[model samples]
Target: MKFLEKKVKSMEPIFAKGGKLEKLHYVYDGLATFLFTPATTTKRGAHIRDGVDLKRTMFIVVMALVPALLFGMYNTGHWHMVAESGNMDLPYLNDFGAKLLYGLIKVLPMVVVSYAVGLGVEFIFCTIKGHPIHEGFLVSGMLIPLVMPVEVPLWMVAVATIFAVVIGKEVFGGTGMNILNVALTARAFLFFAYPTSMSGDKVWMGGQEADGFSGATFLGDAASLVSDSPTVDGATGLMDKFSAMDSFIGIIPGSIGETSVIACLIGAVILIATGVGSLRVMLSFALGGLGMGYLFNLIGPGLGNEYMQIPAYMHLLVGGFAFGAIFMATDPVTAAQTATGKIWYGVFGGMLAVMIRVLNPAYPEGVMLAILFMNVMAPLIDHYVVQVNINRRLKRLKTA
Candidate 1:
C-alpha cells in the first residue's frame, strides 16, 4: 500500500502544475482521488466528517443492484428461448448454463453501451470544465440499462445516455444538482421519442413469439384488456398465463432488471440497512400501490374496464412498480428529505403509478412517470413539512 501510494505521489509532480500534462490535471486528479481518499482536508471551520464517501456509497448501491442484474440476465435468456420455442411450459432454472450464457450475450452489450456513452459524456463535460468527474454516473450508468427492454438498439441506448448526461443531468450543473433521476431521464427520452421500439411484445424478447405465447409484458397485456374477461386470447387467462409465484420470482418477461420482486427487495434491504435509502418512501410507496389496486379491484369487472380487477399484490409485483419503489422513488437527491415528507412523496408516487397503469391505455408502465412527477413535487413536500414544524415550535414558544 505504501509503495503504491509512493508511486502515485511520485508521478503526481509531472501533472502538478507546470508539467507537460498539466492541461489534463482534472483527469489525473479525478483518477487519483477515486483510487484513494483526498489527502487534503479542511484546516478550519466546523464540519461533519463521515466514514464513507460518494464513491463508496455508489459502490454499495451498485452491489445492491447486482442480484437484479444477474436475475434479469438469466430471465432474458430464458424468455427468449421460450418465445422462440413457443413453449410456455418450459422448465425454469432449466439448462442453467445455456440460459445464463444467452442472457449475458444479450444484456452485456447494453450495459457496455450504457456506460461507454454516459461516461464518455461525463468525461467530455468534466474535461471542458477543467473539473474532476463526479461519481454520480457510477450508479446511473448501471441503472439506465436495467430499466430498458432487452432488444432496444445499442444506438438508441447511446443516444438516450447522451441525452441523459447532457440534457437530463449536466445541463442542470451535474450529478447532485439534477432534478430528475438520470437513468429514468434516459428511459423517458427513449419512451417519448421512439415509442414503437420500446413498446409491443417484440421488444421484451429478442426473437419472435410463438403462436400461443406472446412476449408482451404482463402490464402490456393487462392494459389491452377491454371486456370483463381475464383471458387475453381465449386460452389461459391473465392470471393463469402468469402465476403469482412467477411474477414474484420474475420468470415472466419485462424490463431487464425490474422483473424480479425478490431482487428488488434484496436491493431495498441493502439500501435501508446501509442508510443510503429511506424506508418511509419504499414502504409508503408499496402501500399506495396496493391501496390503489385494491380500490380498482373493489370496482369489480364492469363498465368495460377489466384491467381494474388485477389483484392488489399483482400491481406491486408486475411492471416496474417494485423496482421504482425501491430504487427510483428512493433517490436521495430527488426524494423528499423530511421524514414525514418522504411518506407523502412515496404514497402519491405509488398511487399515481398504479393509477396511470390502470387508467391509461396508451402507456402500460407508469412507474417512470410516477417517480418523475414526484421528483418535481419532492421539494414542495419538504417545504411544507419544514413549515409545519416551524409553526408548531413557534406556537409552543408563544404559549410558554
Candidate 2:
C-alpha cells in the first residue's frame, strides 16, 4: 500500500499545470483523491473539517446497499427460473448456489454497465469542465442498477446512464446541484421513453419469454385489484399470494433490488448506524405511507376492491416503497436539510408514493415519482420550516 501511495504521488507532477497530461489533471486528481484522501487542505478562512468526506459518505451508502444487491441477485435467479419453467417448483429449484450463480450472471452486467457508462460520463464531464470528478456517481451508479428491471438491455442502461448524467445531473451543474436523484431520473427516462422494457409483465424477469408464468410483479397484481380483474393464478386470492410474510421475506417478483423488506431494513440499519442516513426522514416517510395505506383500507371496502383494502403495513412491504424510503428518500443532496424539514420531506414522500400506487392503477410503482416530487418541494418545505422557527423566536422576543 505504501509503495502504491508513493507511485501515485510520483505521478502527480506529470498531470500538473505544464506537464504532458496537464489537460487531464482533474481526472487524475479525482482518481487519486478517491484512492487516498486529498493531501491538500484549507489554508484560508475558518472551516469546520471532518474526516467523513464525500467519498466516505458515498462509500458507506454503497456498503449499506450491499444486502439489497445480494438479495436482488438471488431473487432475480429465483424469478428467472420460475419464468423459464413456468412454474413455482421450489423443490427442483432448491439449489441455492445455482440460483445465486444465475442471478449473478444476470445482474452483474447491469451493475458493470451502469458504472462503466455513468462514471465514463462523469469522467468526460470532469475533463471538459476542468473540475475534479464528483463522488456522487459512486452511489448513483449502484442505485441505477438496483431500480432497474433484470432484463433491461445493456444498451438501454448505457443510454439511461448517459441521459441521467447529462440531463438529470450535469445540466443542473452536477451532483449536489441537481434537483432530482440521478438514479431515479435514469429509471424515469426509461419508464417514459421505453415503457415496454421498463414495465409490463415481460420486463421483470430474465429470458426471452416468461413461458407460462404470469410474470407480473406484486405491484402489478395489486394494482389489478382496483380494476375488478383479480387474478388467481396460484389458486390463491391477491391477498393470499402476497401474504405479509412472503413480502417481508421478498421472494416475490419485482425490480432488481426492491423485493425484500428485510434487505431494505438491513440497509436502513447500516445507513442509520453510520449517521449517513437521516432517521427522521426514514421514520416519517414510513409513517406517512402507513397512514395513507390505512386510510385506503378503511374506504376501499366501500369501493368493493381488494387493492384498496390492502392493509397499511402492506404498502411498506411491497414494491420499491421500502427501498426508496430507506435509500432514495434519505438522499442528503435531494432531501430536506433542516432537522425538522427531514420529517416533513419523508412524510410527504411516503404519502404521495402510496397515493400514486393505489389511485393510479396504470402506474404500479410510485416511489420513484414520489421522491422526485418531494425533491422539487424540499426547498419549499424547508423555507416554511425556517420561517416558522423565526416567527416563534420573534414572538418570544416580543413577550420579553
Cα-based TM-score, every candidate:
0.93, 0.94
Q: Across residues 1-400, which tens digit of lDDT does each residue of candidate 1 receive?
A: 8888778878888877898787677677767877888875423211112556777788889998999999999998888888888887989878889989998998999999998888788878887897677778889999999999998999999999999999988898887788899999999999999998889888988655575667888878874533456422221367787878999999889989999999999999999998887899999999999999888777755445656767878889899998999988988888888899999999999999999988887886899999999999999999999999999999999999
* Stretches of candidate 2 exceeding 4 Å from the true structure: 41-49, 89-93, 208-210, 223-236
lDDT score at residue 151, model 2, on the 0-100 scale: 87
Candidate 2, 1-400: lDDT as tens digits = 8899999999989999999999889889888988997877423211112556777778999999999999999988887777777776554348789889988999999999999999889989999998778779999999999999998999999999999999998998877888899999999999999999998787887773655567788778865533353322221356566678888988888889999999999999999998888899999999999999888776675564556756788889989999999999998888998899999999999999999988888896899999999999999999999999999999999999
User: Relative to the unseen true structure, what is the C-alpha lDDT of residue 167 in candidate 1, on a scale of 0 to 100?
Assistant: 92
Which of the numbered candidates is closest to the native, going by highest TM-score? 2
Q: How many Å off is the CA of 261 in candidate 1?
A: 0.7
Candidate 1: RMSD to truth: 3.1
Query: Residue pairs in steric clash, candidate 1?
Result: none
